[model samples]
Target: ENNKHVNDTENTLKRQKTNKKGGPKRDEVWEYFIVDDEKNDRHYPATYYHCEKKWQKGKLRTLKAHLSNECLQCPENISKFWRDKLSTELTNYTRKQKTIIQLPLKQYQITQHFSSDKPLPLAITERIDRSLLKAW
Candidate 1:
């Protein structure tokens, strides 16, 4: 039936939108995280990443940690790109003067006390900072 054909076409289009080259396309601005490297046969299981800007080559595990902790120290071009983007977004948000809801002073103090009992991990803190920067 024509209706069945239409349904199949729509489904194909939806799948195409979600997938590219057999992998789902990531929506995030940064895609530096390492996946399995399929290029070189010699390093089948070993991980690696190439930094074109600095002409530096590194292993995936080490590079992932370094990128997460010291994104600002990445190759100059990449670092500058992120810095400019964040700065512009922050400047625009500050200029807007949007009203942010605030917790009462007493409630904030109590919450702080509970939070102080357990420190957040460095990775978690870094993730939170990145989320905020992206949101801004």
Candidate 2:
């Protein structure tokens, strides 16, 4: 049981909030703003991307420039809560003609767990992308 618990904990993705949004400092990516969209061109305004890192020595290191852009490791993605939220958001996004989001690997697995026993309806099922599903 202890080993199982440890395994569960190890599988989690650690997100350490290094800085706050809307602060005086002007060097970070926290949030993104959707400006305009067309068939190909889509503009995103000012946004922030806070750095995250795996735990070590009881602290976190900034992983912004060091890590590659494609890396998105989040523990919430693997939890059941994320799965339900993503599923719901996908449904809503579909109804609104919006696109489904892409979350990181661990986070994506958590997002899938939200569907436990009850699967989603058929309407939104068709638009779902398998790659995106595997991404989170």
Candidate 3:
């Protein structure tokens, strides 16, 4: 019984040390953003903003200050946000098409070439070529 108690104590200590070494969990960190009422009052890391230009233009204010000042809803700010959002969306869409759609199609064509299979239809090849050139 004494040996069993010692083993249980050792196990408890090991668990405590492991938990301490790992520090707070991911949910604890993310919960600061979602649950903390004062979160907006604190400074955030630099990568939080999507638009560098707008971020640079605005004086560094707490999130609460920005919201209270109506900066987020201002016409100029709204336009900037939309412009940045659209540009990012367009870039992502183009990249997805090129990599996911065009790349696989190109790979298939290459495989056909190696197998001495009939080449891809001329129209498809032409379209892919045009897109590749346009990307450049």
Tell me, by lDDT, which candidate is best: 1
What tens digits encode model 3's per-residue C-alpha lDDT throughout 11-117? 45654444465545422111112121222433233211212212322223343233334344434654465456556756887433455454544335666647556
Candidate 2: Cα lDDT at 39:
30
Better of 1 and 2 by TM-score: 1
TM-score per model over all chains? 0.26, 0.19, 0.18
* lDDT tens digits, residue span 1-136, model 1: 6875675566456535544666445322224323333346322132212332221233443444444445544666655655565567668874447798996664457766577678899999999999999999
The per-prediction tally of clashing pairs is: 0, 13, 0
lDDT of each: 0.49, 0.36, 0.42
For model 2, how does the per-residue alpha-carbon lDDT over 41-82 read when each residue is reduced to its tens digit?
Answer: 221232122223322221111222222232354333333444
Residue 79 accuracy (lDDT) in model 2: 34
Candidate 3's displacement at residue 61, Å, is 43
Q: lDDT score, residue 31, model 1?
A: 43
lDDT of residue 17 for candidate 1: 56
Candidate 1: segments with Cα more than 4 A from true spot = 1-28, 35-69, 94-136
| Cand. 3 TM to true fold | 0.18
